[model samples]
Target chain A: MRRADRTLGVARGLGWFSIGLGVVELLAPRALARGLGLRGQEGLIAGYGAREIATGIGILASRDPTPWIWGRVAGDALDLGTLATGLGRRRGGAGVALAAVAGVTLLDVLCARALSSRRERQPVRSFADRRGMPKTPGQMRGAASDFEVPKDFRIPEALRPWTSAA
Target chain B: MRALVWHGKQDIRCDNVPDPRIEQPRDAIIKVTSCAICGSDLHLYDNFMPGMKNGDIMGHETMGIVEEVGPDCRGLKKGDRVVIPFTIICGDCDQCKRGNFSVCERSNRNKDMADKVFGHTTAGLFGYTHLTGGYPGGQAEYLRVPFADKTHIKVPQSLTDEQVLFLSDIFPTGWQAAVQCDIQPEDTVAIWGCGPVGQMAIRSAILLGARQVIAIDCVPERLSMAAAGGATTINFETESTVERLNELTKGKGPEKCIDCVGLEAHATATLDSIYDRAKQAVMLETDRPHVLREMMYVCRPAGVLSIPGVYGGLVDKIPFGMAMNKGLTFRMGQTHVNRWSDDLLRRIEQGQIDPSFVITHRIGLEQGPEMYKTFRDKLDSCIKVVIRP
Candidate 1:
């Protein structure tokens, strides 16, 4: 597979994953906060969920997903910072979540890098010499003027020029 | 015989299939020498056009030498070199007599189903949907051509396959698009897409003596090719197509607009395009008519909008009122290949234009499945792919 296509496939998978995870975080932010021992931060968690959903939609909808994947990488950093604060209160769930987020962050960074490199690798190709005409376009202009337009295909007679000057 | 067969969406396989046979008196079988992948075939590859069944052979642009002829086939014999037009036609039909071969009344074997879907049956097209006759196509080692007496264009041995191959479809399709415009000496023709048909339309407009030919496309290589064929190119990604066209025509808009980008109109370029994608994903709409909308909005009053692009099923948000008020003449249909093939063949023989310049990739029939994806994705700067079976 081409690098661009491979990376794009990965990006699409990640986009679906984001939407799924965001739905869980959004509808049950209070339960998620309690499990992570960050009970008071439920509102902040829900806001982050909305950001994830928006980024997911951008990645899925846009022709180029590079910018959206970079947005995902930035969101991962914010997620890691939030998880770090919960480490003091709960060691088990918060530690596990932090490790998982870090793994996903690595993937986001790699996908973003690969997508960027693919764009940079494509050089603009020129076909200036592939002019199918026997002569210059200017010289070839009106070359078929001798061929008559079929009667059925001709424009209305009223639309035709009445005189050379007109 | 190995032929490219459609199993499902995005699933084309080179499978060993039964060789075709003559079922009718007028049928002739040809040993296919060369064939091509057309832009319309992409509609089938993406599974957009309906009525396609599994195991249908896939291809349209084809040419070869006659290997066998049925008893009633008087115009063809063994060893005759011929290019098979994509549209199957019966010369005795009223539409055929009027030179509207694309809408021939009798060629489509599945006319009842087509009548329900399209009001009236169009021509039976090779390798297209079953609604157009479900006839087997020419992407294999041998093909069975029905109504072969009137359905083939004989070419002289002096011209190579590359020079006359497109007389079956794109060359005449593009020619008909420009002819629909009825271009005048002072008119400017603006073509959309810059794919093979767009390239041909550019050259056609220039040869017919249009004052200016402008090609709008986002692909750099395609734009460069259009420029090489005597057009002022517009890269739609970096500039506004409407604004550029208006400026080129002194704010009156081009007198002629041709839509070569049909259902798939670069689905993320503008807000309307994105809306089209979203709707298409949910099955709320069937075609993306972004180019249609743009042409309607920007064409000069009393101008012509000639469409060689193919569109299937429902389209949403067309500005019919705007077009109606503008007095724009709309001309669009499948190309009547036989109607214009003789003239195009003469042009090829006279060195007026070389249709072979559009081909970017050539491969054997077994490689057709992979090339389909490459062409669809615009990978490796592919503009056209020709297959030697």
Candidate 2:
């Protein structure tokens, strides 16, 4: 497919996933958290709820991923880490939910890395092989260090202490 | 043949030596049509070049007909009148490719030109110092020119040798300094060291449309020459250069300043004339940065500072902070001689400028030593000594 179409496809897929997660968390809160095997993750669920809502709104409204994908990756990572702490205090339910959060983090990291690399690898034509160009003499790296000879009488030689040298 | 050889500190002689010959494929043997003792040659005279093995030839600035071109030489032919720039280069080197022809990779005449081609960082110069290639200079009746095509500029047939002689070094060098200083059309430009380069810098500044060119030097003849060249001169011993600059520019001071004296040729009346050594190191080390201090004080905020002076290796106490505070733009480099000489020659052809007007002392080649002393003493109205070899 075309590059623009592929980009839009990724954006749409990411938007639907994040928005679905947001609506579910907002609607059920504790039950959704518990059903997702995060039995005691109240604080983490609340944070994810807010982040999901914001990411959902941004993704539906704007085509750019800078606002959407960035919030999803960063906000999900923080919420998942916090939720992992709460799950640590629970029983067998805790292990599955923590594992799920860890998987989400790995996916987010890989996507973020790919996106950043893509931006960096873009072509640039100017400012290439332009170092060490010849500059005029007396113009050093810093400001002008040249001092002008002062006006009026410079110190007369007769007054200076005369010393003979080789 | 006789050479003005340097024996030791303050010792020089005209002694018999074997004449030079065409030693390489690119070299051309030039019968010296004209050669003069440069202010820089005085460094070799004082044994400052540190290459004296009892006999070393000194003299680089020259104009002559090609006596013999090497077998491989292409552009130059026998009997072609050319003015040789001091910094010679082989055109096919890495440095030459980058247009830094002065420090060409194959500039060293002693070593094989292949040294630079093999990625050796050993580009040298003619008799400046051992640090530079230490090629023998052109003060003799005959000299070999390696890398002949790049080093020499072809003079126009209409112009006499005397008219275009200085396009080799001093004239183009001063022009480079002027252009590097970035002197504005209506801005005031101040030049230090009204020696030959300083004088030429003023002349070039006038041609480039400097509203006011103030030349700084204590030498009466040079100061007067600056005045004749239509520049306001600051005779450092007489005038307060800082005060005059402030007065002239309404406290903004000069918009651009050019230092032509470099590190070697800073001749001050306060210093002894017998040994006009590196005043730059002496002042900055012992007392204070005397002249540079003034340049800082007088130069306008965000002004241009051009230095064409020859500075030897390394010094401390350059006012690093002050330069940043003032927002000054600075450019400094060895003259791209080939770039500036052609246009300078055209000016002489058009009668728009006559730089030879500054030539005050005319002497034969035999008088090289004595003339060096005279110019060194700065005596008897000697603005520039022109020696006919």
Candidate 3:
């Protein structure tokens, strides 16, 4: 059976959202590092890109989104801590990057809450229920159970006037 | 019914074959409306995948309207449109119950042959070699679907045949490839071969949150298609994939790599690929796994490598030491289509993906012979072929 569309949709959205930011950081590490007032820490910015991408894939690849979304919360905390460190450093656009990071933190918190609560509402379905068919295996016999080659179905002999080996 | 029959290597013909009827209690006969020629079929076309006899009907990816059913068939009725998964399942075995339907114990009639080769038998596959199961494929006017209730999925009327057809194989195959990689948002994935499976892997990686997807191939059309699917393309003829990938990822190498090109991978100046090709031609090697070796060498330390490509027999000189030293996590298998079909179908319905983007040709079943050559030779920009039987 399929997961609730809203849950998967949100998870996929957040996954792409993380990758979008990750690309910017990976491609323009110096620019992002400077904007966040973490100049000379371009390598650190790229490291965060790697972490963000990983979190996104974790969320997309699994049915349960709570743990990965929670990891995003922790990442938010790290971003804030770094931004806090950058507040006293000499840099440009630090305030802007901090406000942007704070906004994303809010989004991460909201997603984590939604995923955690939905986990309670949506219970896993049993195999029979998920199969979505009318009859169970017990109610039916396999086609080849009492094996006998069909009389009319001839095995081709691969020569002129193909003949049945059976 | 008229069916495409494999006579021998590079020789397929549309021949008059006996109409498929309900042979067993749970069987159903389907009038095939749409079917596809898969990349794996090319292996059989080239005589790479073995155990093919002269009269084996060829095809597996199929969707059709149910025309008849046997006494025990319960879930489907006449006139129902259904998509048949390539692998047949009994749904009662330990493997099937655990959702490992592709390796189910009870399905394969020729289990002894498979067991002898692989040390254990695998699931029975349609239109695949006798090693899997000698069940006739779907590239014909009519097909007999065994285990009808569990093996075929009913499709809603709202979706077109093209949109849902791939639920049979490649979509699930590619999806499993991406899922097994254990992708993190920080991961960069590089996929070899821009074929259908590779293209699907590109889309799967993007959906699964890969940061940068580097696609490697020599085909211009396939490379362009991969780029269109949001990947950086690398033409193996023009660029060194390993070096270019390292350069693209800032000397760290991609964290994940996928080998979508299986046994018959191509090579250029790479010493290993050239050697593999020479050995393969001389019968010393069963497969040319150029991409497998490259993936191991280019993957970052502790990276994950996923293989969706089909490898029939044993591989030689796989560089196990490099994979071990690099701490690479390896995942490869025949797709568990029964497990992932529903989810991928839902994804299609929701407009998250349209699998038909990979289809480059659509012809009647009679064209099977020529299309086989065209597909294998990569002519007419062929990536995937859909047959209207």
iRMS of candidate 1, Å: 2.3
Candidate 3 chain B: 10-residue stretch with minimal lDDT: B266-275
Deviation from native of the Cα of residue A18 in model 2, angstroms: 93
Alpha-carbon error at B87 in model 1, in Å?
0.6
Q: What digit string (tens of lDDT, one per residue) describes model 2 on residues A22-78?
A: 777777778866655566665667667767865655554442354456667777667
lDDT of 3 by residue, A135-159 (tens): 3212221211222222321122231
Candidate with maximal DockQ: 1
Q: Predictions ranked by DockQ, top down?
A: 1, 3, 2
Model 2 gets an lDDT of 0.64
| Residue-by-residue lDDT tens digits, candidate 2, B1-389 | 66666556556666777977887888887777776666666655544344345566667678888899888878999989888888877878777776666667667654453343434434455545545556676777777788786678988778876678788788888887877764444667899887778877877777666667788886665666667666777767677777877887888788788887654433333232112223322333222234555576677777767877765443345676898898766666667687667677766776666667667778776777777766765655666777676
Proportion of native contacts found in each model?
0.70, 0.00, 0.00
Ranking by lDDT: 1, 3, 2
Please, what's the RMSD in Å of model 2?
25.7
* DockQ per candidate, 2 decimals: 0.55, 0.00, 0.01
Report the lDDT tens digits of candidate 3 across residue range B1-389. 99999999889999999999898888999999999999999899988887999999999899999999999989889999999999999888999998888898888889999999878999999998999978999999999998897888888999999989998998888877877765555668899888888888877777766667889988777877777777788998888787899999999888788999998876334567656655665578778788888899998887778899989776799899999998777878888888878777877786667788788899998889999987886767788999998
- Interface CA root-mean-square deviation for model 2: 25.1
Interface RMSD for each predicted structure = 2.3, 25.1, 22.1
Which model scores highest in TM-score? 1
Candidate 3 backbone clash number:
8
Off by over 4 Å in 1: A1-6, A25-68, A74-99, A157-166
Recovered share of real interface contacts in candidate 3? 0.00
